[model samples]
Target chain A: MADQSQPPLTRIQQKNRDLILEGALSVFSVNGFRGATIDQIADAAGLSKPNVLYYFASKDDIHKTLLTTLLDMWLAPMIRIDPDGDPLEEVMTYVRAKLEMSRRFPRESRLFAYEILQGAPHLTEILGGGLRQIVDRAATILQGWMDDGRLAPVEPRHLIFSIWALTQHYADFEVQVRAVLGPGHDPFVEAGPFLDNLYRKILGL
Target chain B: MADQSQPPLTRIQQKNRDLILEGALSVFSVNGFRGATIDQIADAAGLSKPNVLYYFASKDDIHKTLLTTLLDMWLAPMIRIDPDGDPLEEVMTYVRAKLEMSRRFPRESRLFAYEILQGAPHLTEILGGGLRQIVDRAATILQGWMDDGRLAPVEPRHLIFSIWALTQHYADFEVQVRAVLGPGHDPFVEAGPFLDNLYRKILGL
Candidate 1:
């Protein structure tokens, strides 16, 4: 029988898991969860189907693992919004962190977007639990800022939504952004200042 | 052979076409273009495969038709931003119209979101040609407003992108919004005023 409390994954197991996840990310990001197939992921990872299954029980397991990890990374910026930090600086830092994530991890953004677009079937529990917890905490901090007159008074939740919407648009809607901006334009370069100006103006910072 | 450009579609033909498009919208919105099948669309439309094919040659054809019609409706709000109207009013009008579309036609919005998320393989031409043309024209008008000091100066293209992001986020990310807001909270009710406040503050209107 397998040991109930084994040590963490060995080096090879960790490497294989990483390989599977990286391959799954590419497939799932492009094809979405429903559209992607296990064979495709297995082929992408250069592993046999049984080998991949040894790491993940099924396609849903693989997808769930990816999504769980993604949620952690996706919300890290919001979680980092220090309650004790200066209001405007903290908000601005959060915005910058989100936009940088959009620029650096566009596939992850699109993967999440695709899930949300499909009504977040796999993410409902986490969205309601962990996501709501973090958002509520962040919203409380933002409200405190508003109450203390350190930031302009507005709906704190909506403000966070706006930040997410504006920044992630560059990543999730990259094709549309690039189409309108044309060939030579670097969207992130312009987006950084554009968003900074927008938040400043809106927050009266 | 069928006459090439005889009159417009017959009443029955138009009705069937609309039925097909409606079904396609629901399917594509949920499953995405690649994930959706003609049989599913036909079943959703309460028609046989042959009947569906009578109106649209293939799944691609049906998706293309839906996308083409959607682009028109999607951009109509932008096109209605009259150059002669009050700058802020025109911009606000566009924002409201877009938000209303999100509230009324979320499926359409998701269909477009799915296509865009997939790198817009099917929409490159329309995005580059029609979308770019209208955006360029709108950007010109927005730039004029800035030049005349009627509005705050920023990148007009980015301004449009922001409007798209903020407004469509409600529809495209409805699951997340609903999850965070919890039950019995009408997102659109708060969204209307929240967005109005945001744009007013940002534009210094």
Candidate 2:
């Protein structure tokens, strides 16, 4: 959020901030908010403690930066649901985008999962305000599609939840998924068609 | 696990142990394994830290106990998917049972989520050995049913994951689910029919 108001930094400063955020993401994803510490983040980031602190005010600050940045990325796909598009294909696009995120951005997905699992103390405001509005708008659009028989009727609001659940599961529970599938199988690659078929079944291909 | 080998606890001892475990569950559910402490568990359990330690050796001990106990309850549902039962109904039974856990035992659900999210360090053995065997058995049964066309064919292993992801989302992401739906909606209640329709579509009711 303050990304807009903060004065632009030199390339070095920007690079250091990215390293700190990347390191912080690794530590925080494993340890949650309570267990993570500045020293750990600094070590993971390959910087001295002072150097890390110079870029961010506190651990909370780094966590928030990661989360807010994440919230934007998280909401982008939903916001891309165009009302004028073919409803089923539009949804399939969202599904593909989310699965691609799970494949490409698993650490980010786990970090988001940890924050939410911990009650989203830093996130409750945006959750109800920004996130809810976007979800509601998407839900309404889905509802319209359903009413017109352009989409199969289920709870439009909850259908989004199913999408989140199915796609994010690949990332959030990757270990369990790998364990279940055993060797020589890529969970995400297999999941692509399974999910494509699933949404098609629910929404009518 | 030691419940089998240890001398049967006296009624008082059993009651005290239950209290400590219940308290530990509350703390550990909110605080992941690394973030939880003996004093906190004792405080939540209404016992002295020493007393809590007496019942459980350390924080790790308590966490392991909770996890091992949870593993049993978690497997009970999947284990109950009878090979001889009606195919779709059996899957529905598993779905309903998982959802019921989300509703009645959300903390447990989040605790399990937190554990898995962190790579299941303490649980990897069971995950790969005991858990894999059961899931394999269940998957094989479903695959057999699919082979017979008694159930609609989807990826049998992955379908189990979808069940877990959808049902557990209500518990693990309760805050997000609530915020998205706004006021006056019970996520679990609404989820029941939506999920029923979903699985029925996938499995062919």
Candidate 3:
């Protein structure tokens, strides 16, 4: 597996780790967590399962790494929503940011979708701690906007959920969305204008 | 299993068949399609799996029945969005109806969620045929509204997606919503005012 690991992984360790994870993401995203096998992941990485495990402890470990990584990316856009910024612009920023993620990292989005759809069984700790807390803070920001009369009155929390569902739907249900939208329809290009007008109308700013 | 199903289900037998299906819905909705089992459903119907299968073929059969049934119910409210009604009111009615289902029949919502999450493998045929067709028609209705300048000019399909995501989020993500909103918060109650004003703002009437 590497000539007794040749003094063990050092700087090269991080690069191989990233390689294995990239392969794992492609496999896991397509098949789902339970549906995926360690052997398949190893083969995809061009390493043995034990070798893969040598880099990461277990399948769960690999999954956790992928999820935490994706969660950081997912929440970055929401974290950028400035309570101090213009109301409609802030919301539009959030919308475009999320849609952009769907376009750029659809596989990551689908993998996250698979996890949540399965009830967040692996990342309950992350969901309960980091993700949930961030959503709450953002929801509070929206509430603050409503209170200041800078944003139109609405359920700040559900509004966020709508943003998430709409943006993520493009990825999670991409097959169905594409099927229904037909071949020529690019949901992202169509989606940006739709969302911009949506926020403008909802915020009424 | 029962002497050729005890002379086969008759017209009266057909009525009993409906009763078994009715009972399956209550059980499947609460426990989810997978969490639900033949035993729980049979117990709910005061019968055995063999007897249940006599009416329907398998657990998949029962779950498929529930899905098809709910699809009709789910689409009915949206279809009732009168083409001639006050356009804003029409959309608002669709919102209220969807939220009402989310509140009143969350089990149905979860059942659908679980099915879709599992890639709708079992119901892909029905989904491709029935559900997709219905959404197409609704999208057309929405386009009509946009065409008449009755609703804000947005991608009718995405507008529909947002409305769905907004309303269904209350039911589908109730646990997370409750956790963040605090234990005492009733999401629907909080959501009602949020949705009412949201539609009003978006419709701009």
Please report how far candidate 3 places residue B161 from its true position, in Å. 1.4
Q: Kindly report which residue stretches of model 1 are placed more than 4 angstroms away from their true locations once superposed.
A: A1-7, B1-8
DockQ comparisons of all candidates to the true complex: 0.82, 0.85, 0.32
Candidate 1's displacement at residue A21, Å, is 0.4
Candidate 2 off by > 4 Å: A1-4, B1-4
CAPRI quality of model 3:
acceptable
lDDT ranking from best to worst? 2, 1, 3
Residue-level lDDT tens digits of model 3 in B48-163? 77888888888888888778777888778877877678878888888898989989987777677656655777677766676678778878887788788877666767777777
Candidate 1 colliding pairs: none
- Kindly list the per-residue Cα lDDT of model 2 for residues B114-179, writing each as its tens digit: 999999988998888999999999999999999998988999999999999999999999999998
RMSD (Cα, Å) of model 3: 5.6
- Residue B172, model 3, lDDT: 66
TM-score of each: 0.95, 0.97, 0.80
How does candidate 3 score on lDDT?
Answer: 0.77
Show pairs that collide, candidate 2: none
How does model 3 score on DockQ? 0.32
How big an interface RMSD has model 2? 0.8
> Model 1 residue B135 lDDT?
98
Best by TM-score: 2
